[model samples]
Target: MTRRDIEFDAEGVTLRGWFYPAEGATGPAPTIVATHGFSAVKEMYLDVYAEAFAAAGLNAVVYDHRNFGASDGEPRQEIDPVAQVRDYRHAITFASTLAETDPQRIGVWGSSYSGAHVLVVAAIDRRVKAVVSQVPLVSGLANLYALVRADFVGGLRESFDVDREARYAGDSPAMIPVVSEDPLGPAALPTADSWTWFTDTAKLRAPAWRNETTLRSVEMFTEYEPVAHIAAISPTPLLLMPAQHDHLTPTRLAIDAYERAREPKKIVILPGGHFDAYVDGFSVSSTAATDWFVEHLQP
Candidate 1:
């Protein structure tokens, strides 16, 4: 499979990544627009899914959210869920303009934090014919509790308030590790799995990825639940893949969201934790996702 550099404008920021066209194709084909989760860059195994899509006779567009990776945004390394969501929307518009992919048959695929993103993207854009959200977060409150130690909970909240003041006053947003050696320390994700995955697995796959995030990023998590939008993604096909042992996003919350979603939806619960699905367990989920897009987007 071959990929080309690509960029799109979203709310005045330029998001950058790669666009993979279907293998040996000279004409437009079904396309899947994709992005990574919180504290992740495009190189962190997102290409695995995009290449799978390309090999499956579908085009794929993989991009970094604004303010992350090779994208252009101020206050770099800050994770903004709201801005990321808008970037996905603008990615749709960008994909439609590409000569390598079908304009009317675009799909959106995201995992972890971005898994929650696709739901909202699909709900608002009728242009998205299908969606694949893997181990999606149901509620920020639940996810926050699952990600950090209880003793550090108060510290996490306090960091946000402090960061906001600093940010507004032209001070650098409080810097926090995206993954820490201590589970109780302040970080976007501090579990043992994430520590190993981000520190080890990501280094192998996404060497360009940084392990830091802004304090404001974690602070914004509380207000960004997309479970409420899941129901609205109907008429358009939805594919929700939640890992069975994903403590980060939690399988139960995804199941709960799945139960509330409308028709024309399918859920495939696979083995492994949230980060596992990005590497060791990627095959199962990506296979299911590729088939879903081929079946829905291609028809």
Candidate 2:
């Protein structure tokens, strides 16, 4: 149950978070490289999952994504899926170098947006021997249309265009709330559950958590297609956990993406909305991921 504050280099950015060494481990242990989704920081229940893995005799390297949380990056609060994907690989490299980690026995666990990132990472990174993608975004375009009203789609695109021009003119990137009190209001995640989970979690756990992100972050999200690489994750052992009624990263999308993924994969449907995986269904979600890593990574 020992945890330490740690930092590592991702490209040029310094990402920081807590690392938990496996309890009662004798030597280098199988490790999982993990991070939060979208604009979330490590403090948003990532520690809870890491502790579960560590208690199960697996080393866990949990860190913040660049430009978020304790991580160091410029044009702060920006989220570029491409950059985040590269950072996941860098995290793998960082985990591989740790004395307490078995480089050959590495896994990756990501939830929500990061859940999709792990899918893409497992496809291209041979270093990841096992992967757990929880309530992941399969297709950005699809998820966007699912959450946003059809009539407002055009207006949303126009906002992105306007932000692009402002940024080009050297103005600071326009920002938007990650979640809002009104589900009908403008926000990156405009669901009632997202609003409740994020606001409540921030108040109870991570006060430093911000509710804003660069407007361009939403633009980048519309173009990400992580599920396209789901099939490539085969032979590496994939565990796709989607919530039963997830609306943010709709359950159907995750189920469909799981179908596209090759064998050596298993799907476990959680018993609530998307945010419930980190709250009400945390035990189910964390235990599933911990056992998957132990079975495949052999920690």
Error of 1 at 252 (Å): 0.5
Instruction: Assess candidate 1 and give its TM-score to the true structure.
Output: 0.96
Model 1 CA deviation exceeding 4 Å by range:
24-26
Candidate 2 lDDT by residue in tens digits, 95-157: 888899999999999999999999999999999999999999999999999999999999999
The number of clashing residue pairs in each candidate reads: 0, 0
TM-score of each: 0.96, 0.98
Angstrom error of the Cα, residue 266, model 1: value is 0.7
User: Which ten-residue region of model 2 has the weakest summed lDDT?
Assistant: 290-299
Root-mean-square deviation of every model: 1.4, 0.8
For model 2, name the residue pairs that clash.
none
